[model samples]
Target: MSLTREDVAGIARYARIALSDDELTEMTAYLNDAVALLEPIREYDLEGVEPTFHPIGSLVNVMAADDAAADERALPLGIALENAPSRVGRSFRVPSILGDEGGAR
Candidate 1:
């Protein structure tokens, strides 16, 4: 389905995007081309083919094993708080979000 300028404009408005006349024209052509490319796939016969999650067979877990015994070095607290600008007794001190009386505004 070829998209008109009005269709592209409506899509832009719905998406909260500002498009110039040239941009609208370009987008209309681009959308029409994309629809034309997808037309063949949409009309293809897949009567007996089963739906698959992955296109190329089952996927293998590529992540590293979560074994705690693999590493033993613990992170030091001083090193972690070294970059903090404002700290009070081993904790970060941030500006109070409440009012001067420490009550919710």
Candidate 2:
């Protein structure tokens, strides 16, 4: 089913999208074409065919244990802070944008 201007406006309002006239025209054509394409899929015969859950041939992924540490000999805080352009008592210093020029209130 081809979408009308009123249909597009209603859809946009439901989706909270503020579409312009040009954008609405493009979206209308796109939505109508999508509807046209899906109409043929509904006509497909799937009475005996089993439903396919996965389009790609792959097994369900099981995550590995998080106990394994990826990196050995992690750098110390002092060593890491040495590379920074600025520093506080024990942390890196950064420019402030609010009430005070200082950080962490």
Candidate 3:
């Protein structure tokens, strides 16, 4: 299926993104390329091939007897914070990335 400018606009609106004219043009090209790339897959022969939902086989967990267990020792919160290079009070302090630092975007 071909992608139209209206489709691109609707996607941007749903994503809450405000795309400029240049960005819209780029997105249109990208969407077209993506659709074109799928054309080859549509032409592949699959009459005898079994459909696989996963490339790697699905994991089947073996049933095990459930038993009430004793409590286990856990690491202290203070020790966890100590491992971090930066911390404020009891929380880990990550570097600011908002426009204040022009990095969030």
Candidate 4:
């Protein structure tokens, strides 16, 4: 995972970027340092540990109470369309997605 100046230059060329010699040297050092930091994690043993989606244990909702049957309120149609920029009759009016032809191909 060690990166050299030549490797950084090759990467810049492949990405269509024009980097000065100083920039290439700096990028090479930065990438090498990043790889060095990750190298130790690759060797650590994780035999029986479960993969975590979140780093904070409290953030995971392991026992979320079921409130699915709670009374739900619905917004009136007039209130819903109140903030619409454009509306035609009972529906919102939007620009045609079919372009000038006015229908799907």
Candidate 5:
């Protein structure tokens, strides 16, 4: 489908954006050109192809192997928290925001 000047103008009005006549005309043509670029994808014949969540079907969870090695090389908790400006228990303590009453929100 193609877009017209009226369609662009209506969208701008709904979005509460004020555009000059030149801007409106220029944007309408610009959007139409963008749409034209994607038009060729409609010609693809994929009736028998199965839809996939990802483009690469062979992708695997590489993180599972890394998790084992990560546990062996992990830094001790005491050393990791040594340079922290402030901390509470096992986590970093950041200043309260939005005028929080005090402790954890």
Candidate 6:
């Protein structure tokens, strides 16, 4: 498949790219070269090759034991929140992101 200068200009417009006439001309040649290189792959004979999603076809999660030194390195709630800038009951209080009244949203 060959691409014209018009085709490249249209592609640039669709992609929201601002290109000078020189740049459009250059990119037209570059994209046509890329398309021409891909044309040779069409000659590959694949009569009965099954399509695959992954190179390593059927992998499962290879999980190990969760011996993460459970809770020994954990900080207590009061100690963790000791220097908090603002707090409400047991939780940190910050500006609401939703920009709604404090009741529902």
Per-residue lDDT tens digits of candidate 3, residues 34-80? 88988988898878988777677776657645543432444577987
User: Could you tell me how far off, in angstroms, the CA of residue 33 lies in candidate 4 after the best superposition?
Assistant: 0.9
Better of 1 and 3 by lDDT: 1
Q: Supply candidate 6's per-residue lDDT for 42.
A: 89
lDDT of 2 by residue, 1-105 (tens): 578988999999999999999999999998998889788779988889887788865778787566546545567789988899899888987767574755763
- Given candidate 4, what's the lDDT at residue 33? 86
What local lDDT score does residue 5 receive in model 2, on the 0 to 100 scale?
A: 83
Clashes within 3 Å, all models in order = 0, 0, 0, 0, 0, 0
Error of 5 at 83 (Å): 29
The residue pairs found clashing in candidate 2 are none
Per-residue lDDT tens digits for candidate 6, residues 1-105, read 589999999999999999998999899999998998898778888789887777898877697567766756677889878899988778887876666765442
The lDDT of each candidate is 0.82, 0.84, 0.80, 0.81, 0.85, 0.84
Candidate 4 clashing pairs, residues 3+ apart or interchain? none
Model 4, residue 32: C-alpha shift (Å): 0.9
Look at candidate 3 and tell me the lDDT of residue 47: 89
What ordering of candidates by lDDT runs from best to worst?
Answer: 5, 6, 2, 1, 4, 3
| For model 6, the run of ten residues with the poorest summed lDDT | 96-105
Candidate 3 stretches with Cα past 4 Å from truth are: 47-50, 61-105
Candidate 6 stretches with Cα past 4 Å from truth are 60-105
- Indicate the residue-level lDDT of 16 in model 2: 94
Question: Relative to the unseen true structure, what is the C-alpha lDDT of residue 43 in candidate 3, on a scale of 0 to 100?
Answer: 96
Cα miss at 78, model 2 (Å)? 18
Report the candidate with higher TM-score, 4 versus 6.
Answer: 6
